[model samples]
Target: MAPVPKSMSGILIDAPGGADVLQWKTDLPVPQLQDGEILVRNEFIGINYIDTYFRTGLYKAPFPLVTGKEAGGVVVASSSPEFKEGDRVGYISDHAYAELTALPAAKAVLLPAGITTEQAAASLLQGLTALTFVREAAGIKQELGVSEGPWTLVHAAAGGTGSQLVQILSVMGAKIIGTAGSPEKCELARKNGAQWVIDSRSEDVAARVKEITSGRGVDVIFDGVGKATFDLDLEIIARKGTLIVFGNASGPVDPVNLLRLSPKNIKLMRPVLLSYIVTKEEWRSYATELFDLIAAEKIKIAVFKTYPLSEVRQAHEDLEGRKSTGKLLLKV
Candidate 1:
């Protein structure tokens, strides 16, 4: 193995703001390993909406932050007994917008033989999110209870996490209704297994959803569009249904009335991916299942574009502008 470098190039943010805040620097120091941590030479870094939240101070962090949460790379140094110098890994951790990251072994999983580092980077965060949401958040299988699949709705269904949710829900036999901004994205959502696709931009979303479900409303609503769609979710969710609001693509949903949920006996959840996989055991279990699904081709990864580290500003612009579908990645 080659020796690790003393310095590397990465994106840094001095303070909260917009995409302009992401600064590329070539002299950033390679992270020094700590106990229970391993140093990774990142090959690809996953771009997520949460990164924007951190950058804009919506999700507060200290200034001069290295704001990224996930990446896939080869372990170059280890202070953890569970990892070695050449193992391939995908991890969720702070300070990932860099050529190298020192991440806790607890937040990472070993890559199986057939999966490439690129695929690991692409799927780990979003794939596990979809799996956990379906299996636990909505309790899809348990709710089936010997009946036909339940009616489920996914907002922004052609986006990274949304695509994963649609595919997993399809495999679990759920009848999926997906909403995307444009016809192309809506078609992509249908290709990912949405039984019906609504153009949220041009169509009456709530009406289409209600019409498609025969006015029963959907049994499960997976909304990542936050403030823009929360009211619509309330209007269309079925009696005793579950509403899982997981992202803030349109901005955070305002505080709930609680009374809103009472009328329909709705179950409301605002879950974060980190909370679902807190322990090593939990992380590995879901990650294993996620990788298995990918291996079986039950879930397909769609990478919209790969930006060079210096082009991260434009990547953020494109992502925030909603100009791209599927996942955006930064090549490290």
Candidate 2:
């Protein structure tokens, strides 16, 4: 292998605030490969709302932390038997924001043929998250009593993760009702397989959902937006319905009492994707299923936009502003 660069460019968050806090430094040292680790030359880095949480301190990170975790790249150097030089791969990690970074071999997954670097970057974290939401968290089996399919409410349905959820649930025969803030975003959700898209700007969500479900509410509500939608979700959930609160894009939800769910005997869950993907076996199963859906064109992983590494601040600006739908990537 060629010699590693003395330094590489990356975005760092020195203190939590707005997009301005993203500190871009060109002379960041190239991470060193360690035993059981592989060095990668990143091609695409995905920008997720979780990155925003870390950036704005909704989720804490050590000071001066790198700003992203999702990226697709090719192995340039390897010290692990499981990975070799020249292997195309993608990874999710706290250290993936750089041009070159070291990752544990166990955390890396080889990019299957026909899956491009951009696609892998965009889908691995978000797609697998959506899959686990429908298959595991939503309890689409006996637990939720909707083995074939259920009426699902996906908030922010045109978003990177939400869009993936809509697509996957669409394939699984679910009746999906998606909520978006704008007409365009609503249309995007509809395009990705949502049967009904509600424009939050113009419609009362509870009323619309009740109208659509004829007051029975949906079988499941996948709510990524927290405080802003929590009450509305509870109101629109069906008897014994499941409500999966996955992300806090708008803001953290307020404290809740277990008694709050007694009205309908609703099932409330807070699932973390990181927990589900921690084991290599679980990661592989979800990732394989995600790629298979993509390969068969059953799911479309949307790359809404891309920015050069230098423009990472603008990327963050757009993401935090909710200006882009689907996946946003930084071309590294």
Candidate 3:
């Protein structure tokens, strides 16, 4: 191994506001490890909508905090008995937008053999989110007591997390109807295995869903767009359908009405990934399944763009402008 530095470059959000708050600095220290922790040399970082929230103060974080929540890298130092130096790994953390990171063993997962660092970075946070939504929240099983061709509606179909959900549900033999804002993104959704794609900006989401399902509504809806799409999701859900509200890309939903779901027999939930993986065994199992899907060519991670660490301000601008499709990565 070559000599490693004591510090490296990273992107930081110094205040809540806009793109101006994203600052580039090279003095970020190579994080020190405590017991059961590892020092990693990151190669790639994931850029998602929540990262924008952290940047804009929609989600609170300490000022001057690192801006990424997901990354993949090689472990350079460790005090954990299970991890060794040079082990490839990936994880989601509070602040990971650096060339180096210190992660607790509990928050990290060893990258499966044959999976590239890029794939791991693209998969972990988004893949785990998809798994938690379908398997845990939606209760998607071989038998959910629906018709042979059950439908699942996913908002922001071309996004990192939504793409993963399409892949997962398609593999489970469910018909997936996805909403994207553009024709290009609609094509991307179809290419990623969505059975139907609705241009949410140009089409009536509820009507398109009804047409796709032949006058019946969908079996489940994976809603992350919150205020913009959550109400429409409720309108299109079939009786006893499950509506999983996992994020708020459009903005926070105000005053949820549990009473509205009564007539539809709907199951509404706010699912979180942390709740789904309560133990090391559960994390390993989900990671293993995700890797198996990749290894078997059942899923593909779409890396839409990559920016150098210093250009994260431009990256956030592009993301907020809705110019990005699929996962955006920051290369260290």
Arrange candidates by lDDT, highest first: which order? 1, 2, 3
Give the least accurate 10-residue stretch of model 3, judged by summed lDDT: 141-150
Tens-digit per-residue lDDT, 106-128, candidate 2? 88889899899899899988898
Pairs that collide, model 1 = none
Task: Give per-candidate clash totals.
Answer: 0, 0, 0
Deviation in Å, model 1, residue 332 alpha carbon: 1.2
What residue runs in model 2 are displaced by over 4 Å at the alpha carbon? 141-148
TM-scores of the candidates are 0.97, 0.96, 0.95
| Candidate 2 local distance difference test against the native | 0.88
Candidate 2 residue 285 C-alpha distance from true site, Å: 1.5
RMSD from true fold, candidate 3: 2.0
lDDT of each: 0.92, 0.88, 0.84
Per-residue lDDT tens digits for candidate 3, residues 1-332, read 66678878887666788888777888877777799988888899888888888787887778878878888999888899989899999887767888888888877888877898889888888988897677878877555322244678888988889889888888777888999999999998888888789998898888888888887799888988898887788889999898888888889888877799899899888878978887888887888888888899888888889998788888888888889888888888
Predicted model with the maximum TM-score = 1
Per-candidate RMSD vs. true structure? 1.5, 2.1, 2.0
State, as a TM-score between 0 and 1, how close model 3 is to the true structure: 0.95
